[model samples]
Target: MNRPLYALLIAAAMLSGCVTINIYFPAAAAEKAADRIIDEVWQLKKEQGAKPEGNQP
Candidate 1:
């Protein structure tokens, strides 16, 4: 019983070490995303301004 438990613990430790965590931060991609967000907000503002106010049906 003790032997099997030791083997399982060792195996779990080895497997955990094999995992890799990758972090990416791309400046160009971030800039493009920000530009797209700004563009969408500007578009919404334009559409809102082009519409008539005070609920005319």
Candidate 2:
């Protein structure tokens, strides 16, 4: 019983060491999203017949 418990503890420790976590950020995708938002805002402005702020028409 003692031997089995020790083996199990060792195995658990080894498995814990093998765990990994990863995070990813895609800059290009973020830039594309920003561009889409700007385009939509421009379209909304056009539909409302209002010039965007700070722009000469």
Candidate 3:
């Protein structure tokens, strides 16, 4: 029926106004993360030739 079609059109129009999209990129945060990863890799290399601390067999 035309009544249902009109109702569907009105509902579609109402919902169309609610569309929103947002995107964000944090460069400082990404740089900090990369630095931490690099530090961990270096620490592992430094400790590779060192003995483990604490009780061990």
Clashes of each: 0, 0, 0
In candidate 1, the residue pairs with backbone N, CA or C atoms under 3 Å apart (3 or more residues apart, or in different chains) clash, namely: none
Cα deviation of 10, candidate 2, in Å: 18
Error of 1 at 30 (Å): 0.6
Error of 3 at 25 (Å): 1.0
Question: C-alpha displacement of 19 in model 1, angstroms?
Answer: 10
The order of the candidates by lDDT, greatest first, is: 1, 2, 3
Cα error, residue 27 of model 1, in Å, equals 0.8
Q: Deviation in angstroms for 57 in model 3?
A: 49
Scored against the true structure, residue 3 in model 2 reaches a CA lDDT of 100
RMSD of 1: 12.5
lDDT of 1 at 24: 47
Can you write out model 1's per-residue Cα lDDT over 1-57, one digit (the tens) per residue? 699999999999877765532244666567656756886987634344433334534
**Which segments of model 2 are wrong by more than 4 Å?**
1-22, 44-57
RMSD over all Cα atoms, model 3: 12.9
